[model samples]
Target: MKILQRKRKRIAAVLFTLTLMLCSCGQHAKTEQKHDWKAEAETASVYCVGKDDCFLCGTDAGYFGQNNIGIVSLNSFAVMPVEINRYDHNGQLIEENTGAMQMENFQNGENGMTVSVMLEPDRGIAHISISPNGDATLDLASAASHLCCDCLAELVSQLYGSVNGIGVVNFSTRRLYVLQEGVTSFGAGDYYVHCDYEALGGEIKILVIYSSLRYENLK
Candidate 1:
C-alpha cells in the first residue's frame, strides 16, 4: 500500500511540473505576439526615397508644392532616389546631417524619431515618422488629394501585409468632412484612419494608426 501511495504522489508531481511548464510557454507566446510586428520593423532595412526635383530647396517642383516622399522597406524599392537632403535642421538628428532614419532612431516608446520633409524652401511638413513599436505617423499635405490615400496605402504595404490584394478606395470629401472641420476617425480593416482639422492653423491632418495583430504569425 505504501509503494502504491508513493507512485501516486510521483505521478501528481509530474503532472504539476508539466502544467507549470505549459503555462510558462503560453505566457511567453503572448508576450511575443504583442511585439512581433515591431520587432520586424525594427530589424528591417528602411529607406527614404524622395524625388530629386523636390529634394533641394527652391526647385520648380517646390514652387508648386508637389513632392512624393516614400518611407519604405528595402523590399519596396521604387523609382525615387534613396538619397535625401536635410529637411528639418531644427529637429534633433539621429546623426549630424544624416537625412535618413538610423537604427538608433528606432524605439518602442514616446521618444520616437520625427523629421520634416520640405515641400519648398519656405514651407516644410512633418510628413513621416516611425517607431520601433510598429507605429507610424504620416501628416498628409493640406490638399485633399487622392495622393494622400496612395501614400497611406504605400506605407501600410511596407509595414504590414501587402495592400496589393486590397481594393483601391479613395478618401472622399464626404468621409473626411473637409467642410465640417473637426477631428474624425474611421476603421479600415486592421488600420484606423483619422482626419483632423486644426481650426487654429486652418490645416487638415490625416493620421493613420495601425491597430491589429497583423504580425502574430510572423515566423
Candidate 2:
C-alpha cells in the first residue's frame, strides 16, 4: 500500500509539471501573436496617383502604376483593398480602371493618392471620396448625360452569371443619389442589382464587383 501511494504521488507530480509547461507554452504563443509589424517598420513618404494626375504622399511600396491597393492583416492575411476611388468622381469608369491595376509592397495606414483618367470625350465630370474605413462621399457632382446605365448593368450581370448557383440575374439602371452610400440606386449612370444564390451549408452574400470576371483556380 505504501509503494502504491508513492507511485501515485509521483505520477501526480509528473502530470502537474506537464500541465504547467503546456500553460507556459500557450502564454508564450499568445504573446508572439500580439506583435505588431506596422509599429516596427520604418515609415517612408511615397506618392500614389489620386484623381486624374493628382498625387498624394504616403509610404513608398517600390512599384508604380498599380490600380489596386490592399492592406492585409498579419494574423489572418485578411485583405482590405483601400478606397482607391471613393467619390465615383468621374463616375465608376475611373474606379473600374483603378481597380484593374495591382499593387505591391503597400502597407496599411500609408497615405496614398490616385490619378484621374479622361477616357471619354465628354467634359462633364464628377469625383467621390471613399474613406479608409469604406465610407464614400462625392466631392464633385456633374451630370453625365451620355452615361450608359444599361451597359454598366449588363457588364455587372454578365460577370455575376459566370458564378455557379447565381440565377435569374436582373439588372437595373439608376442614377446614384447618395454619394456616401455604397449601394447602387436608380440613376442614369450607376446601376446595381440584387442577386440570390443557393450556397452550400448556408446563404452567403457575394458582392459581385464586376460581372463576367472569372477567377482562375490555382492548384
Candidate 3:
C-alpha cells in the first residue's frame, strides 16, 4: 500500500506540470496575435517608388477656394527643368529656361521639395503659389483688361482656376494664362500666363512681352 501511494503522488505531480506548460503556451500565442493586429492597422496602403516620385505627392493636395489641386497618380513624378527667372533676362527663348525636377525622400506623404511657376500677360500679371499642403492661390494682375473682369474675378476666387469660367474669354484675342499646378506624384504650385492681345474683327495679335513667371520650390 505504501508503494502504491507513492506512485499515485508522482503521477499527480506529472499531470500538474503538463497542465502548467500548456497554459503558458496559450498565453504566449495570445500576446503575439495582439501585436500583429496593431501593426496591420497602422501600415500604409501605398508606398513611394523613389525620392523623385516622393516629391510629387504633396503638390496641390488641398482645396483652395473653389478648386482643388492634387496628384493624379504616383507615375506623374518626373524631373523637369526649374525656371529661375520670371522673365528670361538674357532674351533666352521660353523653352530655354527649363529646369529639372530632382526627386527626394518622402516626407509624411508630402513631397520633400516644392516648386513655383509664374504667368504674366501683356496687360497684367498673375502669381500662382503652391505648397506641400497642396494649397494653391492665383493672385491676378491688378490692372488686367476690363474684358477679363468677370473671368479674372472668378479665377481669383479659387486656387485652382475654373476651366469653365475661363472658357468664356476669346482664346484668340485673350491671352491664355496657364500655370502648371504641381509636379510628379507630390508637388504643388500654380501655372499662370498673361495674354496681352486684342481681338479686332476676329483677328488676334499676341504681343510677346516679358510678363510671365515660372519658378520651383526646393523645400
Residue pairs with colliding backbones in model 1 are: none
Q: Give the alpha carbon lDDT tens digit for every residue of 1-219 in model 1.
A: 999999999999999999999999999877744544333333331322233322222133221221222222222111121112233335322224434342212222343222222222122222222221211232222111222333333433333321111111221111111112222555533334454444233333444443546467657
Total backbone clashes of candidate 2, pairs 3 or more residues apart or in separate chains: 32
Which candidate number maximizes TM-score? 1
Which rank order by TM-score, best down to worst?
A: 1, 2, 3
Clashes of each: 0, 32, 41
TM values, all candidates: 0.26, 0.25, 0.21
TM-score of 1: 0.26
lDDT value, candidate 1, whole model: 0.31
Worst 10 residues of 2 by lDDT: 135-144
Worst 10 residues of 1 by lDDT: 165-174
Between the candidate structures 2 and 3, which one is better when assessed by lDDT? 3
Runs with alpha carbons beyond 4 Å of true place in candidate 2: 42-208, 211-219
**Residue 95, candidate 1: C-alpha displacement in angstroms:** 53
TM-score, candidate 3, is 0.21
Which portions of model 1 miss their true places by more than 4 Å?
Answer: 51-219
Q: lDDT value for candidate 3?
A: 0.29
